[model samples]
Target: LVVRLPLYIHLIHSHIHTFSFSYILGPMLSYFNFALVSASINIFFFIAFLFQPESPYYYLMRNDVDNASKALSWLLKADEDETDKELELMRKSVEEDRQKKAGWKDLVATPTDRKALLIRFLIGFVRQFCGIIPISCYSTQTLKAAGDSFIISPDNCTIIMGIMMVI
Candidate 1:
């Protein structure tokens, strides 16, 4: 929910600025304003990220259980007993992950791995045939082509598409 909400809001803001500037301020100025808005959002996101607590996983990976406990406790609002149990579980999971240590060779080593690889490749190949990328790339133009069919303006249609993608 946290991730989705921010993405939705960002897309909505982007669509609004895109339509407003291109319609009212002209195409050339809109490009400049788009750059300005992008930079501003990036700066804001960076500043906001700085205030977030370091992930408990980071400390756990470094074998700093004390700091991991502290961070996890703060994040989860859990009691010390609960924190200890969670920390132990995380430690075991991390150790197991490190022990597995699979290399690129393992990708084709077994039937299961081969099947997984084939499935992944097939999915990627199929995805390229989907018109989503082209449609997204030329969304404004695509909407403008159907300008008469939509009750709202093409600009609003594009904005709604952006919102829907985020959702």
Candidate 2:
């Protein structure tokens, strides 16, 4: 929600400027205003993230059982019995992930690794057919083609899409 809200704000600012709605305030300088606002918001998000909870698994990895249990308790909604069980399960999953992590040689030698490689390959291949490349490269043209459906200008929409990708 935080990520998308910035894109919406950029779009709204674009609309206001395009329509000369902010002409009474000052000149319509887009990039400078957006950059200042985005930087300010990023600072706020960084502070907010500092106050957020650390993952229980992180504490477990550091061999801090007390902190890990506390984190697990919070994560499991303070359900005491479930916290221990879930923490143990998380430990097992983490160990398995560490063990399963493979190198280039293991990628083709192991069946599981080969399956993972093929899945990644297929995802990459399929994305090319999803029209993302052309829509991104020729975004103005794409927006123009879809123009009639929207009340907002295609240029503003394209600008918003760019911001969304950046965020």
Candidate 3:
């Protein structure tokens, strides 16, 4: 839930911005209406954070089992006993995984795993540095050069590129 809610809100904001820009900004922009749209999205997210529930997983990781149990009970509408049992299971699973002692060296020690890791790392680095942003920027410029009006401004274009990097 900790990772999911922000992504959900971001998806909502992106959809809103895309629709607003395509329909509204494409026709208007007399006085920085795009800025207003951005501001409204920010305000909506701020309000959402005010009402967002705390994550049980985060509390559990912090070793605050009481708060974690309360959070789980609130989220699941379950009894304390059930919540405690679930939390204990989750904790055991995590500990078991940790006891496996997986690390970079484990992968490097195996030829096939080492090759896979190297390939994955190379692909990730190439995608981050070369693939996505340049393609998007080129496409945007091509569209602009062809006199195809776009609601996606250069700033938003850069922001989208940044988001791809972070993701």
Whole-model lDDT per candidate: 0.72, 0.68, 0.66
lDDT, candidate 2, 13-34, per-residue tens: 7645433332221122465885
lDDT of 3 by residue, 82-132 (tens): 878887876776567667988768878988988999999998898798766
TM value for model 2: 0.49
Worst 10 residues of 2 by lDDT: 19-28
RMSD of each: 6.8, 10.0, 7.2
lDDT of 3: 0.66
Clashes of 1: 0
Angstrom error at residue 137, model 1 = 3.2
Task: Tell me the spans in candidate 2 whose CA falls farther than 4 Å from its real position.
Answer: 1-29, 104-167
Better of 2 and 3 by lDDT: 2
What lDDT, from 0 to 1, does candidate 2 have? Answer: 0.68
Task: Give candidate 3's error at residue 15 in angstroms.
Answer: 13
